[model samples]
Target: MASIYDFEAETLDGRPAPLSAYKGQVVLIVNTASKCGFTRQYEGLEALHRRYRDRGLVVLGFPCNQFGQQEPGDAAEIASFCALTYDVDFPMMRKIDVNGPKAHPLYAYLKKAKKGVLGTEAVKWNFTKFLVDRDGQVVGRFAPTVEPKALEGAIEALL
Candidate 1:
């Protein structure tokens, strides 16, 4: 019964980031890519972060390159793109796999806690989102097609 707080990941700057630091906060976790079709969702995600962060919401972007090699950028390149293009101020994690054998452990836990559509655990594409409550429980999963702004209601409920 591991909660998200049990996991740790490296930040875009290559520094250790413990999920425990976000304990008791509602978390929006998304697998992102700089060159994917859904990459624009970063704007909406940043909006969510800005609009609700003070109210206990934290948006975490995990740059993933598993699909079509959309996020084929090094740490610096990814960070620069996110900042310059979308003005993303939310925490961004280092690039990592969202599927397959090399998937990050945090993603593995997330997929297990809340299976995708059709009960499948694999992440189909970039921008897939997982919402965690203040208690660190996975409460919802959103497909890549679900726009980040559409999640406001669900996020407000948890807040």
Candidate 2:
């Protein structure tokens, strides 16, 4: 059984980001957009990352344009926006499709591991979050509406 650690993605700066590096950490994987109404959640997510990172929580953001084209910027632009606007210190991956034929393999694995409402595998929108345990298992799927703070308890438990 392949786990989340089996996947690799590109960092916003274009470096290889292998999930295996986070094998013993609690991970919050979110598909994000810069122009969405929930874009403000970046602040909250950053807060969560700062607050729990010492306890083994890692917040990994993946910029996606599939939802209303909210995140249309290129890698450098996205990185600048996140740093200047939200002071996001957590890892941000390069833009990637979270749906359709070109969806990233990590996302495909996450969706299959934890289907959404009514067992639908498709990611409905941006900011959708997947929680992974230290053992690299997907344990929870949160909708775009769920705030990052709301997952603190769950993350703490995993840590």
Candidate 3:
């Protein structure tokens, strides 16, 4: 079976970002959007990153526009919004599709590893989260409505 480290993504600046760089860390992967109602979750995600990063937690935000075109901005605009509004310091990847034929490879792997409610593989909406343990195993799948703070216990356990 392929581990999360087997994947790679592009940074918001279009730089190469290999998942291998985060090997052995507890990772929280989120599909984000600037215009979505849950966009405020960025603050909670950033808080988690700041609190547990030293303890090996890494939160990765992937801007996704698949849902209602909530993230309909270029990389620069997304970066600016995240930084200026939410003070997001964690890594934010380039915008990518979370469903359909053009979906990002990492999302494909994630959905397969951890199916959503009722055994659905498709992500229902933006802000959906995937939790990966230190060993690169996909351990949890959270809905867009699942608040970031709600996962603190799970993250602490993994750490």
Q: Highest lDDT, which number?
A: 3
For residue 65, what is the lDDT in candidate 3?
95
Taking every candidate in turn, the Cα RMSD to the unseen true structure, in Å, is: 0.6, 0.5, 0.5
Q: What TM-score does structure 3 among the candidates reach?
A: 0.99
The stretch of ten residues in a row with the least summed lDDT in candidate 1 is 94-103
Off by over 4 Å in 2: none
Residues 22-113, candidate 3: write the lDDT tens digits: 99899999999999999999999999999999999999999999999999999999999999999999999999999999999999999999
Candidates in order have lDDT scores of 0.96, 0.95, 0.97
- Per-residue C-alpha lDDT of model 1 across residues 26-139, encoded as one tens digit per residue: 999999999999998999999999999999999999999889999999999999999999999999999999889999999999999999889999999999999999999999
Give the TM-score of each candidate: 0.99, 0.99, 0.99
Cα displacement (Å) at residue 81, model 2: 0.4
TM-score of the candidate numbered 1? 0.99
Worst 10 residues of 3 by lDDT: 1-10
